[model samples]
Target: MTSCEVGNDPFLITADQVGKLSKETRVSQLGEIYKQDSIVNRRFDSTYIFGGNEIEIYETSGNQLLRLDPKTPGDTASRIGDIRILDPAFKTEKGLSTRSTYKEILENYTIKKIENTITDAVIFLEEIPAYITIDKKHLPTIFQLSTTHKIESSLIPDNAPIDQFWIGWE
Candidate 1:
């Protein structure tokens, strides 16, 4: 007997045993929200809104985010720098979804300058809130996007090449 019984074949593996092998791994952490004013730059600080909510980033060398608050004295008010976005919900017609998640907006993006100010950047998904532009150092410097009519769950990742969604009139 090779430690195998006739009734207990490979197919006899129970669900409870499978459950025992399952383990949980830590993915991300919750983010804290803040609202304040900036006294240094006298403008709405950009650090608050830079990193998305509750999302942890593995690498943030070329990411960018806009500040979202004011500050008091001796405070570096507005700054656009590398950020981490957690729990990013794609914009859907019914509003943002709490289910689907993405690591980064432009994970493997490529940019081509169509014109001087008008550039064509290819992103993984379409209907993104902003298109991030990277510099020679691969640091995101410019972020541009247009507003458009929200399609029902339209922001879902489509395998399509180019996105035809537009916010303003043609």
Candidate 2:
């Protein structure tokens, strides 16, 4: 329940526990614990037309694990939902992540600066009000875990960069 949290702090994922892994332990448990700059891809949605349905990425070092998305809906179709950690030695149990810089996350939270420029800084996690992001060298790249309900960061656009960081279930 807790351990599945890939990068840190209560980053839980349900949908029947990623639909019970199995595809060789979801490609060998994060590629045997981030085997230094690992990478694998099976992406699709080339603007979704039916033939565009697949989605199974698993990067390493910079940490990304969007396991599945067969049909998207409530996200049980493939499980392992969204998670993006820009490495920083991977953390989250309050240890933070994305190698934590930018003055150590502005001395630990309270950030906002939207309207383009790589969509930098917009963290908001006062206990599961999730909406994390970082780009202007702050590192921690996106953690939009299911919006945490009531999310409305201006519908998250600001010129969409930082690898298009936006996971949804709304």
Candidate 3:
């Protein structure tokens, strides 16, 4: 990832810069790489119209990395007005990606488990507006890194992977 577009160090990609990334991926000659996708760049738009271009998709994960518009999630997006990252290749300073298990998150950040019955659960952080949603094992599924006070309850696609959901500024 050091030779990648974002930069040489994954730690430089802080929680604040999460949305700027292209949530989609592809298996390049070098390996799996995640670059900026136009649809993801246009996700902040309130309009639900994306003209005629086919939404860019990540090859390996098969997740729609971008959307025509978030307001109308009939296509790829689950909701509008928020950053959603489903790519496991994206990592944190400690190399904790969406693919990391719940137990791994505990090692990086000291957090108590939240009693959740649903498949999608959240780990609310006291310091940052971010809340980490994880599976039963405590692995991070999605990160609600919202500083703008967006509603937590948003639409999630039926068939989309439950591993990565980013809820923050679009």
Candidate 4:
């Protein structure tokens, strides 16, 4: 009878090889921005998502939300060009205006004017202003573009860096 068994090889998988394999692969996703009711009872919420290298910003107040999408979907290629938010006071060190709501922001803003125009049967934002207004309150309040909440970036991935055990295999 012929023996068809092969001996185990420990040299093929060494300690260094195992260490190299343990290195994790990671992808970044944006974070959520929100204001809790516990503090001042202000109604503000925002969720940011980054995937395939693109950034998305979703802002919510009351029952309204606005979404901003990036040009690039690849994480390494995407960058934040310009971001504007309306808040409580129209004062900042950066010299940006701040109104309480979207209506106030648009009214106080000096750069862009809100006018009606018709050309190709489509209504669009013609002149991109320095700030975009998100008016949540409409009534006795003086409508102003004010930024009360701060925007930030966060990382999101299915598995943490320490969890990705297998990747880039031939």
> lDDT of candidate 2 vs native?
0.37
Q: What is the TM-score of each candidate against the true structure?
A: 0.18, 0.22, 0.42, 0.24
Per-residue C-alpha lDDT of model 4 across residues 1-170, encoded as one tens digit per residue:
01111112211111111110111111121231222211111222336633422222233443222122233333433432222222222232222232232333224333223211121111112222232222223211221233332211111111211110111111
Model 4 accuracy (lDDT, Cα): 0.22
* Candidate-wise lDDT, in order: 0.22, 0.37, 0.40, 0.22
Candidate 2 deviant stretches above 4 angstroms: 1-38, 45-83, 86-95, 98-106, 109-121, 124-170
* lDDT tens digits by residue: candidate 1, 1-170: 11132123211212111100101111110011111211112223266644232222221343222222211222333222222122222223323222322223223322221111233332223342322222112112232232132212223233223222111101
lDDT score, candidate 3, position 66:
31
TM-score of 4: 0.24
Please provide, for model 3 over 89-119, each residue's C-alpha lDDT reduced to its tens digit, 9 standing for 90 to 100: 5566666555665555555655433434355
CA RMSD, predictions in order: 18.4, 15.0, 11.2, 22.7
Model 2 lDDT tens row, 1-170: 22244323323222222222322233334433344434454544444454433334444444555433333422333433344433344343444454443344345544443332333445544322234554433322342332223323444444333322222222
> Order the candidates by TM-score, highest first — what do you get?
3, 4, 2, 1
Model 2, C-alpha of 7: deviation from truth (Å) = 20
Tell me the spans in candidate 4 whose CA falls farther than 4 Å from its real position.
1-69, 82-91, 94-109, 115-129, 134-170
The TM-score measured for candidate 1 stands at 0.18
Q: Give the Å error, residue 94, model 3.
A: 1.2
* 10 residues in a row with least lDDT, candidate 3: 22-31
